[model samples]
Each structure stands twice: as structure tokens, then as C-alpha cells.
Target: MQIYEGKTAFRGIAEGKIKVYRKDQQQIKREHAENTQEELLRFERAKGEALRQLTGLYEKALKEVGEANAAIFEVHQMMLEDPDYVESITNMIRTQKVNAAYAVASTGDNFSQMFSMMEDDYMRERAADIRDISERLVGILAGRTGSQMELTEPVILVADDLAPSETVQLDKDKVLAFVTVHGSSNSHTAILARTMNIPALFRVNIPLDDTVDGKEGIVDGYHGRIYLEPEPRVREELEARQAEERRKQELLWQLKGKENVTLDGRRIEIYANIGSFGDVAAVLQNDAGGIGLFRSEFLYLESEDYPSEEEQFQVYKKVAESMAGRKVIIRTLDIGADKQVGYFQMEPEENPALGYRAIRICLDRPEIFKTQLRAIYRASAYGTVSIMYPMIISVEEVDRIAEIVGEVQEELKQQQIPFGDVEQGIMIETPAAALISDLLAKKVDFFSIGTNDLVQYTLASDRQNPKLEQICDPHHPAILRLIRLIADNAHREGIWVGICGELGADLTLTETFLNMGIDELSVSPGLVLSVRKKVRETKLGEKYN
Candidate 1:
């Protein structure tokens, strides 16, 4: 057996034939076009076709991966329609009198290379996106039928690396597992594996060439190993392991429709975090009790301009209605940090996360904040809706939000607009907010501790930087202490507290959080069932009391 070692992306076991997945590379030849106008027309038609294809893929991804991960397509659509990108391709066709395919291919190469050479890591990643869109245009120009790998049978698919666009187009059932020659654990492949519950291994320096195709392979995600043409004894052991995994999955399914209560009879709320109205389907499928964190920023991030009050109203209304009376805690626009939109036209900052973000922006720009508040208030008429503000530092910010919300309610009353009772809450993310939670808790009905940012702010680390990924500890004692502190303070004020961040989904600390009197956990839809299983298995009273 040829053994390969890699980092575990997802924990599972699978054995199947190997399939070396190579994306279709369309060769473009430079040719002089007799009519530049006709070539331009051809490029435009292909661009339109590419956009259409992206939309279909996006819809498919929404149902499969939810709106957050599926948003790459929307970004791709914007990149495809970028004026600068279009101008470069058209300029080549007009000036050089080249064929549309050649012009697109050449321009795409230049742009992709330019991005690849950029100093920023995030910008370097954009190089792959640029290439993905460019290749689509060229393929469309060449009359290619599809840009997906066709798998007739289940196999362990190996690749050099996968872009988010390519990974979404893959058929989950047909692929037994994913083994990549190069990719970080946070890569889209890993995220997709977790979401789909598939075995995956990354950074395995395996032969990605066609010669390895059709060889029998085994993926042991639990052990972080890949066995090619395994020995009979090893294969048998792995087969036994696979059977146990299936039995475990069947047990997890049985936990569905069961209460998310601990063995100690402690019943706490379990909710799903979503990014768009499209994610409501996933929320229901996973059987979450409520929508704890409905990120309203996607409406702004995905738009060409500021989303209108009416536009935001429709989205919020659909989500509230879809929840069917379940509590929907919608967080107001948490933009300007990591998620930068060009339309805002804000000046660059040394540390964008600490400067001009979340509640800070909303308080400064009352008109923008009021527009979203009105939409949420209007949607409240459809179902139970609560508002949460992020990046809050003090009680004054909560008071300011209450002031604006009061004006919004008054305006709606004067205009005879129908609205409903909406609870106001602020996120306890900053150290300042956590430190004074007792005072801030009095101003709001609930507190959702955003651990992702809380940890970042408390430790003074950039959460987005890959280099600090290991050093920035989510399980740091300081963060745990802060969570307990916030929960304690909120409890004293007779207000509920919830954790709506990455740490909430951690199974290792499930009992610790339960003992701390955490009221709720808001995690991704894929994790709801697993966390429920953890909660049901824990005996908090017996262990701690």
C-alpha cells in the first residue's frame, strides 16, 4: 500500500476507486478577426451566457451549502460584469482585431497574473476567481457544453486544488471523498466536506496526474491518512470502521425531533445562524428552534448600491414568514470589517476591524440605520423578529439604537404603517461590552455574545490573518472567562444571553457552557444536529453539581 499523510478536513472513512479530477482547460489560439464589431458581439453574448450559468450554479449551491458559502457566485457575477474587466477584453478585440476567445483568454491571463502577484493574501486568492470567470467566457465562446466533471460512479476525487466555484458544481453523492495536493484546512474544499459530511484530506503530495486514476483508494479522515491499493488486512479494518461510522450517523438522525435537553434536564435553546432568506430552507431542514443570527449584511454586500428599504423589507418579510413564528434575531448591517463593499467609499484604515464597523457605522449613519430598522420593524408584522446590533462597546450605543428605533416606530405610527413588537439587543463582542454587560444588559432584552469578534478583540489579534490562525486561540481562558462574565451579568439583569459565534458550536466546551447558564447556541445549520447530540449526551448536573 502507498501511504500518504495530510491534515484532516473532515472526520470520516471511505474506500473507492481514485478519480483524478482535472478542470477542462480550453486552448485559445490567437487569430485575426475580419470584423471587430462581430467579435465584440460574440464576447457580449458569451458573457451573458456565463452570467446565466453562474445564476443556476448559485441556486444549486444555495440549497446545498446555504447562502453564505454560495455567495461566491454573486461575487463572480459582479466580477464578470465589472466595467474594467469588460473594457480590457473589448479593448483587445478592438485594437488588435483578435478573435473573441483569444482576447478573453489573453485579458483573463493578465488580470489573473496581476492579482496573483499582489501583496495581500486575500487579493492573491482573487487570482483564482479571476481565472475561473475568464475561463468560463472563453469556454462559452468555444461552444463548450459544460464546465463540470462527470462522475458516473462513486470515487475518491483527487485534485491539485479546488476553487469555491468548481467545488460547488461537484456532485456530492458521486464523490466518495476529496484529497487535494494543496489546500489549507479553511479552504472551500474543507468547508464543503464539513457541510456535506464527506471525508476530505488536504496538503497530500500525491500524484494528481491521470496515471493514478481508477486505482483503489481509502480515505481515513479520522487518522489523516490515505491508503492507495491497500492491503487486504488494512482494507478489512477500514471497512469495519466505515460500518461504525454509518451506525453513528443513524444514531445522530435519531436525535432529530428530540429535545435539545441535557441528561440533567437542562433545556436550552439551539438556533441556526443564516445569511439570507435563501438559508431559511437549511434552517428548517436542520430543525433549529429559531434563527439566532440572521446576518442582514448580505443584502448590502450583494447589491450594486445601498439596498432600498422596500428591498430589505421583502427579504426580512420572507425570512420571518418562512420561520413560521420561530424567533428570528436579525442583526443590523455589520459591514466595513473584512466585508468591504466599494459603494461605501470609506477611507482605508490600518485596522478596519477596530475602525468604523458594525454598530459604530450604524450610530454615525442614522439614515442608513433607520432604513434597515424600518424594514425589520415592518417584517415583524409577519412573524416574531428581534433586532441585534454588533460591535457594541457600551450602554450608550444601545441607548442610541433605542432612540433611533423609537423614532422609526413613531414615524410608522404617523404614516399608518403596520409593524409589530420587536425586541432590541446588542452583541457583546468587544471587551468593553463584556466587561460592562450588567449595565448594558439593562438597556436591551437580550445579549448575543459574538465570540468570533470577542476573542479577536480581547486578544488583539487579526482573526482574518492566516499566519495568526494557530496563535489566536478561540479556547483561550480569557475568552471563556468573558463568556461566563457576560452570561452572569445578563442573568443578573433578567435578560437572556446566547453565543452566536464559532465557539458556540464547539462540542468540547458544551458542558462548560451549560454550567455557565448559557441560554442558547447559534451555529451553522450543518452543526445544529451534532451540537444537539453533544448536548443530549452531556450530564451537566451529575458532573458538576
Candidate 2:
């Protein structure tokens, strides 16, 4: 009976109430398992149950999005099958009558220990996912389901936080909009919202409890604005905007395959930014010309240990094959302090953004780095696979990594491994990396300027941090200059340069980067066609080529 007003991202409205539930507790009958045989039997039962639950969830995911989209869940299944995830819990249960919380706590401790031994953030994050999943399962055993906000009526979801799985799985037809009191733009939940094209706002400054459930509310996710019950006139205006949004969607369909050349006949490479082999299908679905930047971090995020080179090869091969020889540029692990994966035991620092991450982690862990290199190299045989290193700072670091890459290629050749001759490159992210672009260009095959990090590094502000969020501007003169320098340097050396950051998809920045001489522009799959249209509006040769 009341109306709320706010900037709307997704169109439509629903109303619902909040339902909160606590974590579950699993019953561990320790005393009954005194004998070794009893202990083994108990362990087997627990493992089987966990595997069965994981399998069911994965199967459900496959049905929803198909095998390609379900690929991410495969990693969760692996975690359930992980010896540490299942066995450690079994052991704890057999040795003592620990509740699910205690057992999960014990397993979590051991998980942290194992992660500490790892050097790659990609691998380390997997450990964290395992712990997170395990703890979640333990909560299930303890009857601790997620806070189930009541949806007796279609209502906007109000929560302190939400899981990506929950957000994606929510009945979009019923849920109107989501407003979170706390979350990040990079969280899986946010990614899900973007994927679903849903209107969602994260890090809302106001508390959800401030507005009583069942009372009308409004959220404008794009502008980060909200309104309590508004005047009837305001509601009428919102409904009109929603209608206009529908109109735009209809018009956007005209952009498909319309050509991505700028107004002056300058062609630009518009590709998709993917996280896993699963996302390759989305790229094709969206008719993205190719894969721009494939974040290899997913391989680490869903794993307990370093992915075997052979394992990585299969994944890379699937993506390359799916792309059908279209360019697939893979960026190596970019894990760091703020992105702490349970497995990478980095000494927590006050400033994780500036601390050790990306190239820093790779150099410190050569063996792990080489394993990934070997995998990428092997996959290169299947299709056009170019490798890019992230978070490089100094020319010497580039030299060191390039030397290691050379060693990998030589080893592959000596071993007679089936691999393609892959191109090697570095991401121009750090201020140091940008300043030394000429020096780095002399060492690597190409460059991809990660403007997101470059902006943060140049401004000395952590984009991930709240206080500095306002300062993380990609258009800042310093950031623009750094990107221009790296692009100009790479082209001067006859090496190609592309941008795989958020800025690439930004329509406003398209002409700017094009003017800076970027050859490729990688962005989210949904934005590809639009960016391509923007490119076709520019004259490449006359402006910068």
C-alpha cells in the first residue's frame, strides 16, 4: 500500500519479509567408534554423504545452466572429494565427539595450515573455498541454513550479505531487487547480479533493519541511492523508467554483429573476459569475437592444492577449442593479500593491495609458476593461447619471469611435450610497471594494461577499500598517461597491446583507448557487442593507427 523511490537498475518490483536461520550442528558419535573398524566405517559414511550432497548440487546446477555453466560447481565437487575436506573431518569425528562446529573448526585450522604452504593466490583461494564450503556443510549438519528471508509475497531481498549461489539461484521472476548493507562489487553475489542483468546494490550505507519488512522500499543500484515510501507521483515516474528500459533492450538487439569498426573504418578487437572454461560458452552465446582475458584464478579458487599441469592443460584446451581459434589471452594468477585464499598464508598486512600479489607471488613460487606455464604452453598446441603475467613492477622481474618461461619452453621441447609456440607478455598494472614499459616491452611479447590496478597503484589508494573508493578513477590523468605509455611502448616494439580491465568495456573510454592505439579491447561478455558498436564509430587509422 506504500511506495518507495530510488534509482532502479533492474526493472520491476516485488515485496517480501526477512527470514533468518542459524548454522546447523552435526551429531558426531565418537564413543561408538572406538574400534579401528568402527572408525573407518564412520569415515566412509560421512564421506559418502558429503559426496552425495555435492553431486546433487552440481547436477542441479548443470540442469539450470548446462555443463558449460556448471563447470564452476565441478570445483566444489572436487572439494567434497578432497582428502583433506572429507578425511580430516572424519578423523576429527572418529577421535572425539565433536559437534559439526568443532569438527569444522578443526578442519578449518588444518585447511589454513595447508594454504600457508602454497605460494599462488589462485591455489590459496581454493583452500579458502574448501574451508568455506566445508564450514557451510557443517552448518547444514548443525541445521544452520542461510537466513531465509520470507517471500510470502514477491519482495526485494534485504540482507547484510548474500552468497553468489543464493543470489543466482533466487527466482528472478519473484525477487524484485537486492539491497545489501555490506558487500563488494567484486563479490560472487555482485557478479551473479551482473550476469543475471538484475538490479542490485551492494555496500548500501543504510541498515536493512532501519526499514521494516513489508514496508515498501526502493533501490537504485547503479547510482547507489535508495528511497523509503515515496509520493505516488514518484512511483509513476519509476514505472515509466522501467518501461523505457524495456525499450532500450529492444533497441540493443540491433547491435548484434553490426560490425565493431569505428566511424573511420578502424577495426577493434572486442572480446569477452572469462574466469573459467564454463564462461567460454557465454562468450560464444554473446557472440563475443574472442576471449580477451581469461582469469586463471578460478583454477586456484576452487582447489585445495596446485592444479596439476595436466589438469590445467585440459581446462585450457577446452577453452581454446571452444573459442575455435579466436584469440584467448590468459592472465596468470593475480592473487594477493586482500584476496586471501585460505591456502596462501600471507602475513596479513595493513595494505594488502600494495603488498605482495600477482607477479610477486609467481616469482616467489617459481615451481608453482612453472607448473601453470607448462600447462598454458601445452594448451597452446590446441589453439591460439597467449599468456600474460600480472602485477609486474620492475624490469628485472620481467626478465626473471621471461627467463623462467624460456626454461619452461626449453624443458617442454627437450621432453618432447606436445605444446604450441605461445606468446608471452606482462600486464602493465603497477606504477612501476607503467614507468618501465619501454624496458618491459624489450623483454615480453605484448602488454595488456590493467587500468583497475594501475589506477589504484598510481593514486596509492586501494580500490577495494571504502575510504579510497572515490579516488579509484580510471580517467585520472596519471592513469591515462601510464596506459598510453605502455600501449605506445608495446606498439613501438611491434608487439600488440590490449586492455582487459573494466575501462575497456566502459563506452566512455572506448574512444580514449582507441586514440591511445590499443589493438584489442576485452570486457564482460554482455558489453562486447556494445563496445564493438562504439569501435565502429571511430576512425582507427586517422586517429591513432
Winning candidate number (TM-score): 1
Candidate 1 lDDT, 293-362, residue by residue in tens: 9999988887879999999999999999999999999999999866877788789887677798888888
- Give candidate 1's error at residue 277 in angstroms: 3.0
What 10-residue stretch in candidate 1 is worst by lDDT? 536-545
Segments in model 2 whose C-alpha atoms lie over 4 Å from true places = 1-154, 203-219, 225-232, 342-351, 539-545
Give the per-residue lDDT digits (tens) of candidate 2, residues 1-545: 33223323343432234322122334533243335455455445555565665566556655554443444465666666667666777677656744444565578668866874665433444454555566556555545444343355566676656654455455666676777665556554555566566677655554445454556665545455555665577667666776776686666667776767777677778888887776777798777888878989767765666778888989999998888888889999877755555576678765666688888898999998999999999999889999898988888887898799989999999999878767888888788888878888888888888888878778877666555656877778887777888888888889989888888888887788888888888888877767776777666444433
Separately for all candidates shown, the number of backbone clashes (residues 3 or more apart, or on different chains) is 0, 33
Query: What is the RMSD of candidate 2?
Result: 6.1
